[model samples]
Target chain A: MRILVVDDMVTMRKIIKTQLTKLGYTDITEADDGTTAVEAIKIAVSSGQPYDLIISDWNMPNMSGLDLLKAIKSTAEIANTPFLMVTAEAEQKSIIEAIKSGVSNYIVKPFTPDTLQEKIKKIIPNPVK
Target chain B: MPIKVPKTLHPFINAVEKTFKILCFLDVTPGDPIIKNHKVSDKSISGIVGMVGSKYIGSFVISFTAECILNIVQKMLGEKYTEVNDAVSDTVAEITNIVFGNAKKELADMNITLEMAIPYTIRGNNHIITHKTDGPYVVIPFSSSLGTFTIEMGMEPKKKDRRG
Candidate 1:
């Protein structure tokens, strides 16, 4: 399965990518910001090889992960894709907002590799091994 | 020196302890809280993030010496570095983002609705951070097995807000 990781911070992107790699994921792509991620997702869908999973940071430079999730949920073509939201803070209000926006799962920052794997497993039970 | 830290600053103190422990696997011990003037600078590298609330606005800064930062990064990413570079600076920004984000949650529990923007990383010798607010800065020092670091915070409450 293909995955797209979107984060504004290079370090975070690298960290997540590394963790995902260790979890047996090889077909992974990265987008620096939410705007770019939207374009990338659209391109992937148009090319007939849409990403199976999207992991995005909640706070970004251009568009936030919530907005990106909303856009994907509103668009019929990519609405079904699984989305994992990464954030540093998990306030109740924001968590409810993300849930309402149709996020598959959410994880807080400074999480361990085991925690990441657990969260991913909950979303993608039969992910590419 | 043992100083009386404001209750508002406790969230930040908690953020630092939790972030460092989880991310870098370091046992961090909080030192005394030093209240200072409007502007303060420490160490060689710093990650600064600005925060704004309906009733208050301020900045949170985390500073580390070159040795301290490098040690922390090595433990965090499982990589060693001798000098501060773009990658190291990027790590600093991420740390500030996570720590501040963690603090915002507790602050919200106290009825303070604060929004966090991206963080800026500064590197050099004795780089100064001049906060925009007129409020006093609270510089809290922390120590770990790796090294030492400090977090400075300041907030300016609006005129109508009695509790800053």
Candidate 2:
């Protein structure tokens, strides 16, 4: 499945990409922040390589993960795409906001591969074993 | 439930310990949190990242001396930092983000979840970050062979919503 991992930090993006690869996912793309992520999504759809899932961070310059998620869900073509918000925001209100925004799942920061995989499986229908 | 001071503080210490070990290849031991009204020179590099999720709305700040920061980035990049520049600044921010991320994970079990914000660094002296709520700040100090550093956690515990 094609996945888009968004974060402003290069090291973090690299870490997520590495983890995705370890999870047996080969088709992954990256964006540095919300604005770029939105553009990337548009391009992907225009090229017929729509992302199957979106993993985003909450705080970023230009736009944040919450904004990015809102943009994705507002668009009909990508609205159904599974979105997993992986962040270090440990507040109940933020989680509620994410849920209200239609996020498929939320994973807190410093999560292990096992937790990430579990959330992915729960959100994606019949994910690869 | 409010986080018990001691229990709530352990994860932060562990995160700092683990981060130094992994990134700087240095061992660390956390000292008592300096909560007294002692003054610390703010003329150090400060990296701040916001946290959002199930039970906390706060941020983490890592402050260190310029020389100490250079040493850390040197270790992180596997090379010596000759001067302070964008590369060193970026490295410090990344290190802070990693440590915060690690700490957030351990705190999750206590019904605390966090969304990470972009990491940004400031270089100067005599800077102090006050928590939004009038709560005591937990200042965790660590000593390592490279140098000494501190992790300051300014957080307000999440309050359960009655409607939910």
Candidate 3:
């Protein structure tokens, strides 16, 4: 499955990529910031090569992951894509906002690979199915 | 006078311990807290987060030596970094963000609303970090296989002549 990982930090991006690879997902793309992620998402939809999953960092330099989620959910074309928020912000209010914004799942930072797998399973149960 | 140690400090400690364990695969626990040393910059790389809460208003800092921090980045990226670079600096900031974010959530449950500022980083060898706080800050030391660093908190930053 095609996936997009968004984070300004290369370390975090690499960690997530490693965990995803361990889960047998190698078709992954990455964007450093939310604005670039938006552009990439729009292009993917246009080419009919839509990403099956999107894992984004909550805070970023340009657009934030929350805004990107809102933008994605508002557009009918990419609204249904499974979106997960990977962030260090564990505030209840922020979490509520993401839930309200149609985030499929949320993974707080400093999480173990098992926990990451659990959240992804919650989003895509049986990707092969 | 020394401010009474706030009960909120426990959650902050827990946050740091847990974050290091999960992210760097290191087991970190609190060492004896040093009541002295007003400056927060006690290591090579330090990341600080400012907080404004109802009952507490101050900033928290995490300071690590170059060896400790570089080891962490290497573990996270599955690569080696010999010297301090932008990537190492940014990773340290991200770690600070995660530790602070975890603590902020726990503290919020206690009715202490803390607004977090984007983390700032300081890099140097044996440099002093100055933040003027309203009260004497509490310095809690922690040790891991990588090295030892301190987590400091206070009411306000140092007024003038802030260095590293």
- Best-matching candidate per TM-score: 1
Flag clash pairs in model 1.
none
Candidate 2: residue A14 lDDT (0-100): 60
lDDT of candidate 3 over B56-129, digit per residue (tens): 56778888878888887887777788998888888888888899889988888877778766787888876656
Best first by lDDT, ranked: 1, 3, 2
For every prediction, compared with the true complex, DockQ reads 0.77, 0.19, 0.68
- Candidate achieving higher lDDT, 1 or 2: 1
User: Between 2 and 3, whose DockQ is larger?
Assistant: 3
Q: What's the distance in Å from true for residue B159, model 2? A: 21
Q: Write the residue-wise lDDT of candidate 1 on B1-164 in tens digits.
A: 56898888899888888888777778888888988774646588999998888998888999998999999888888789999999999999999999999999999999998986888988888687856577578888988888889898888786578754
Q: Quote the positional error of residue A107 for candidate 3 in Å.
A: 1.2
DockQ of 1: 0.77
lDDT per residue, candidate 2, B1-164, as tens digits?
43334566677788777767654567877676766343344536777776666666766777777777778766655557666677667767777776776676677767666766567877666765544445466677777777777877667766663235
Backbone clashes for every candidate come to 0, 24, 6
Q: Runs in model 3 with CA error above 4 Å?
A: B1-5, B126-135, B156-164
TM-score of each: 0.93, 0.67, 0.90
Candidate 3 root-mean-square deviation in Å: 4.5
Cα error, residue B124 of model 2, in Å, equals 7.6
lDDT of residue B159 for candidate 1 = 59
